[model samples]
Target: MKYIKKYHKYIGLFGCLLIAISCFLPFIKYSILNINETNNFFNGDGKLVLAINIITILLILFNKDKTSLISTVSIVVILIQNILTINKDIISIGKLGYIHFSIGFYLLIAGIVICIVYPFLPKEKNIS
Candidate 1:
């Protein structure tokens, strides 16, 4: 807990970085069509996720106050919503091919989780 608090800002930054990168990676793939495409600009909700990550990054860089914490929580909510929506879309495509969630999806989840959790950690102890 102490370690996490001590480097909370950096941890958040890393999560933001992950979210940013995930936007460019393959979020989902249609095995039948061999479509291993990136999310974000092309398809899916990666663009919004990336946008939120950028906002979170700015908040983390500029302030560690309640607003930043609130934004992180909001981002997590948005991320989860996107996930569910995508799942629903996938189901709607039923039998279109073997749908496989690629690394980007997992990474985004991990990143959002990290971003949300760090805000609630106990403050670091001052050694000075």
Candidate 2:
């Protein structure tokens, strides 16, 4: 826990980096009888990732309590969006494999979790 508190910000930053990189990675791929396509631009969670990234910046700029609450809300929003997509089958990976999960989505999700956890870290104590 102490180590987590000590490095939570870094973790969050790494997550944000991952989100940015994920934007360029192959998010989904599809193939059909005569054509194939992929979505790497922002992918499925691009907008959400953008939101998380912005909120992460806010978390870093603000103090505790407020940051914590905002972080929690951000987490909720990401989860909600993920859930909604799952329930609605928004991506459509149909019989033709219209869409498929890619490395980008995994990286994006990892980054989001890390960012969300950062706000709950314990503040560093002054040894001096």
Best by lDDT, which number? 1
lDDT tens digits, residues 11-124, model 1?
Answer: 878878877787787777655455554444226666666776677888888756345667667767776787687688678877765666788778777877777766666666
Each prediction's Cα lDDT score? 0.70, 0.63
The positional error of residue 110 in candidate 2, measured at the CA in angstroms, is 0.8
Q: Which ten residues in a row are the worst by lDDT in model 2? A: 63-72
Spell out the clash pairs found in candidate 1.
none
- For candidate 1, the per-residue lDDT at 41 reads 23
Cα-based RMSD of candidate 2: 3.7
Spell out the clash pairs found in candidate 2. Answer: none
Q: Which stretches of candidate 2 lie over 4 Å from their true place?
A: 41-48, 61-94
Model 1: residue 72 alpha-carbon error in angstroms: 2.8
Using alpha carbons, what is the TM-score of model 2?
Answer: 0.65
Q: Please state every model's RMSD to the true fold in angstroms.
A: 3.1, 3.7
The sequence of per-residue lDDT tens digits that candidate 2 reaches over residues 1-128 is 78876765566667667767877887656565557767773655666656666676666655443464465466557646765765455456456445467786677677666666666667566599
